[model samples]
Target: MSQLTHRVGVALWGIPLLVIVVLIGGGLFALFLAVVCCLAANEFYRLSESSGAAVSIGIVCAGLLPLVMHFRPDWSLYFLALGILVIALTLPSHRLENLLGRFSSAAGGIVYPSLLLSFLVLIRDGAWEKHYYGGMVLIYILTAIWICDTAAYFGGRAFGKRKLAPVVSPNKTWEGAIFGIIGALFWAVIAGQVLKPVLTVPQCVIGALIVGTVGQLGDLAESALKRSAGVKDTGNILGPHGGVLDRFDSLAAVAPVFFFYFKALGMV
Candidate 1:
């Protein structure tokens, strides 16, 4: 009935299913991520359309190309190059500005929703290779991000004074952002204690900092995109929460950061 009600209802069903998919960690998870990225890419294209830069709908298939890189992450460059070439070829326009606009939008769609989200698959698959706690790592990341966001929202509502990014997201405040970071650290400490097989307390704290800061920036980046496009919410697919891109913006931003962190530590 209410927006909060819708949010909770979706999470109630969605979280469990997400846990299952991440834990499964293979083709099933890859297929699931492919669908989400495609939908998010479609919404991003719609946003670009609203900004007067229309990309070819056919290029939405470019979302699937990233999952192809799940097994061979090095192929990302090739896939991106091919996507750019295809976009340049497919989107024919008379004005040079129009062509550039379309090309930029198409390329952005490939990177944001497609290439960025693919790291989630890589995170799960790579981590799963070494330990059973791999899925738990993903779950920890998601949970920390969610907690950070939730704390930010509520904390902002209660004690928000200074604007964090008034131009992009007017409601967000520095107070809320600090609260978000604290929430993330809180969860990381708890997870570190339990996920001893994969992470140390120090690693978890570092992860909290990365996910907290990067993930919030991702949210702001998405908000900036929506603002520039002159719209609220990328799409209404997620009811009160907006769309797939709206929901997963933070995760998309954090996935690569965490993935690389694990890689650097020789964990994934």
Candidate 2:
């Protein structure tokens, strides 16, 4: 099959199941996120390695330690994350030379994948369960982001005339962004209606805009990384769609933002 066919097939087959499993909310949901975190971290490590940063496979396990400690919020996962930070920073500056440069690369590894991705872990462990309402928020954030992406594609094709951030994602445009936010708001409304007892329309619209904007920013952030890496995409795992990181770029960064917003509203 062509790459386009491959891409469409994967999205069609995977997104529904993934969404349903996530909406169900339980050990299965947490486990699924853990797996996603693992894959994203590995992809980040791979990109870092290709960009001339050295990292051990053990770091993946080390990265997961924060999630484990998240069960006990009283204890600072920061300390464990900091420990990993120190070790990674201290990684023999002489191993591949450019001591300071290596240190910077190592730092990005921790920030982008490990620390940022851990917020979902915190959400799962937090006492957000008023009938698993937090799960609804999480689901909405992801769904809104996905809608943004989908809307961007069709909107760009149909009406895009100005670049939104050409340096980051050229195919994305102001027109597409407008459509994305609209699409995000549409889905957010649906989600709110579906979980009517849990969220109000105003809350749903605001949350969708917040997540959609943040998710788009996250996508741009990942794009910056890919630009730095001198690649067209993150990997080829999804054929024309790129790799796991490419697919989940916004999801990773948006998770933490959603956590923060929910906290401010006392939703999670």
Candidate 3:
């Protein structure tokens, strides 16, 4: 019944599934992400609807656009551009009112989880020479985000005073943010030590700071969406954890940042 209990119970079931999917990094991993994209797109459409926007079913199909990256990464841009154009052009005919609002929300739903999450597939498949090492990189990022989230949750509960963003996410506090960054720093150092050949100490520390900051911001962004929609959680798919979007919001933010960081460093 407690939040902590719900968190732990969900982790028990979810973590293993995640490990299995990440380990099997081919069609299986792509399929897993595709499924998540569908669920998240549905949640986003539902959220947009709550605001009186009429999202089209084609927008939901657009969620599958990112899976193209798994096979043809270069085509992703065209897919996104064309998909958005189609969604926009179709909107005027489908609904007579609030065309702009509906189009923007529909386009956003397609891009957010679908486009952002494709980076995970890219990371797992193209980031490194060895498949195993690529998996490790993905796992490292996931672990760092988990550390940050867990620390923030408890830290806020225990020592929170100043609210971070009272209007966006009333429960978050500056104290929690500080603790979360600290947790990320700690893990980054350990990870850097273990992956010394691939990552330097400085890189780890800096990456952690960037990831921690962006991950929290990503969480806040989702909170803003939920607040706008006037909902408590995205969906009931994850039980106490909310939904796929709720669980992966931080990941959605962290993945692109982390991937680009490695790419910029010529590591990827």
TM-scores of all candidate predictions against the true structure: 0.92, 0.85, 0.92
Per-residue lDDT tens digits of candidate 1, residues 145-250? Answer: 9899999999999999999999999999999999999999999899999988788888999999987799999999999999999999999988888999999999
The parts of candidate 3 lying over 4 Å away from their true place are 1-6, 50-62
The TM-score-based order of candidates, best leading, equals 3, 1, 2
Q: Which of 1 and 2 is ahead in TM-score? A: 1
Estimate, for each residue in 205-227, the C-alpha lDDT of model 2 and write its tens digit: 88788766887888889988888
Evaluate model 2: give its lDDT.
Answer: 0.70
Model 3, position 54: C-alpha lDDT score: 31
Please give, for residues 1-268, the per-residue lDDT of candidate 3 as tens digits.
8988998998898899998888778778888888898889889888888233235454455556656878888898888887788777777765568777788788887788788888888888875656777677777788889999989989999999999999999999999999999999999999999877667778889878976799999999999999999999999998888988998898888788877887888766
Q: Could you tell me how far off, in angstroms, the CA of residue 108 lies in candidate 2 after the best superposition?
A: 2.1
Q: Report how far off residue 209 is in candidate 2 (Å).
A: 1.3
